[model samples]
Target: MIGGFGMWELLIVLLIVLVIFGANKLPEIGSGMGRAIRNFKKATGEPEEIDVTPENEKKKEEGEKKE
Candidate 1:
């Protein structure tokens, strides 16, 4: 029941996300979440940090180009 989204509620939420993002952008969203989580851990002074994969690196690069 996190954020008013329960287990089955999450599946319904995911379906909405799938409709909005489509299959192509879904992978990008997942990777972006991973990088955000990594950066968050670093900012919080967590001893262990997760590495962002190459796919995430490419997505970040694309976003920077748009700025």
Candidate 2:
């Protein structure tokens, strides 16, 4: 059991999430959660190097490079 949650307990929580958010929205939720985690780590001074660029800015740079 990780973090005091047994396998069955974790499964139940996941089921609840699936019901509430549905499968289509799960990926979006996961990505947003991943971004939040990365930001939290950066804020704590644990990782000295990180890419802080917004997605649109990166896409713009790529477009300019290709032109």
Residues 1-67, candidate 2: write the lDDT tens digits. 9999999999999999999999999999999999999999878977667799999999999999999
Distance from true position, residue 44, model 1, in Å?
0.8
The number of residue pairs in model 2 that clash at the backbone is 0
Candidate 2 regions exceeding 4 Å error are 46-67
Give the lowest summed-lDDT range of ten residues in model 2.
41-50
> Candidates' lDDT values, in order?
0.91, 0.96
- In model 1, the runs with Cα more than 4 Å from the true position are 1-4, 46-67
If scored against the real structure, what TM-score would every candidate get?
0.59, 0.66
- State each candidate's clash count: 0, 0
Across residues 23-55, which tens digit of lDDT does each residue of candidate 1 receive? 899999999999999999878896566766698
RMSD of 2: 12.2
